[model samples]
Target: MDIKFESKEAERQYLKERLAAGFRIFAKYGFDEGPAGHISLRDPINPDAFWVVNPFGLHFALIKASDLILVDESGKVLEGGANRHLNLAAFMIHSAIHTARPDVNCAAHAHSLYGRTFCTLGKSLDITTQDSCAFYNDHVLYENFRGVVLDEEEGIAITQALGDKKAALLQNHGLLTTGGTVEETVFWFLSLDRCCHSQLLADAAAAGTGGATKKIGDKEAMDTWKVVGSRKGGHFAGRALFDLIEVETKGDYKN
Candidate 1:
């Protein structure tokens, strides 16, 4: 869909609102994980900078458009207040991604329960279900884990590992997903977590039965991805989720 804005401010507002909504929806679904996760969007007016959630203390559910912090490429807070700080790990990871991939307008990283568990196996999601097919040949597995990602070198390594992929499973860590829009990126994060949950359940069942689960062929999986993994599909899914959250929270996030 072609999004037309009356002015630059309107576009910036649209981006801010969506970024806030993404945080709230992630919190609603238990993706917050004790201030460990972050969702970031490229600044609408300044492509070299991005906006991210405040560091380490604020609850994701309570985040509003006005609560977001705008940061430059060097991880310096430019627009948000002095009390608001950006997480070093968030800066290391997201900055690398936004710098490396100009096409990625938004990047989401979270230590979700199932996603973390699935990452321990050092494997990508298999095409066991149609939903899993969304990641078929589209995700990467970052097999190296060098403790906490505090250094720029670690972040650059991750960026190289995630080259041109939509999602990445960080070994012994968690999941990272990127997209052209906040809605699409958030939806992919949600979908990836669900796929991880489904895969774990399937593996347990197959282990008990001593039988292998059926798999979809590469061609079929790729074809299904075209329909289910498109940015348009993700945007629609995210909008549906945002609508539900708006009703549940009574649009409090807009404040």
Candidate 2:
């Protein structure tokens, strides 16, 4: 069947649904807390604009597709029923990525426990398992911790640190992932979160009874990416994930 969004309302609704899906998945994996953390998508036709972040202070479990605020690449609100202002750090962090990397249509960042733990250690996420392997040689490390990213300058610094990597571990902050599309970015974050969790578990096990060291070979890193990139899902999968999330959340992202 051919699905077409023939009207602006339809397109807005479609985008809203996709945004809602991102929220649900993040919530499902416990990547959010209170109002912290955010996910954003670039406007498909314009490189200088993007969807506004869902207002800060909302529960991830309650977000809906329609509650997403529309914003320009400069973080100015364009549409949606959300509160006028967004979280300062999110605007600084997300807007920078959107502006600097036109290739990245979707960007997500969160203070998930595992990701936060790894970020605090000042260590990169080593490619130890298949899950973490997708990020092998593909993550950037941002060591500048300038408190909360509250301005365009900090945002620019974050973007510079992101460079060409699809993922970045913000020192003393959290994890960030970007992609050519929302699906890809969301999946990257999901995978990154899992990878961090796995490493933590392994670390715990190693220190459990005896001082056993967990080591992953160089070849294992290459092997991990091989397994991950083998399958290409494209746009359909991202839209599907969004639609599924819309159904699950019942379109309740406001409050």
Please report the candidate that would top TM-score against the real structure.
1
Q: lDDT values of the candidates?
A: 0.88, 0.75
Deviating ranges (above 4 Å) for candidate 1: none
Instruction: Name the top lDDT candidate.
Output: 1
- Candidate 2 segments exceeding 4 Å error: 1-9, 209-214, 229-247, 250-255
Which residue pairs clash within candidate 2?
A: 52-69, 63-253, 64-253
Candidate 2 lDDT, 55-143, residue by residue in tens: 56777776766667777766678776547666777778888888788777788999999898888888888666766767877888899
Clashes per candidate, residues 3 or more apart or on different chains: 0, 3
What digit string (tens of lDDT, one per residue) describes model 1 on residues 1-255?
368999988998888888889998999889977778898899979899999887456899988888888888998888863467678888899999999999999999999999999999988788989998888888999999998789999999999999998999999999999999988898999999999999899999999999878899989998999999887888878778878888888878776
- Angstrom error at residue 157, model 2: 1.2
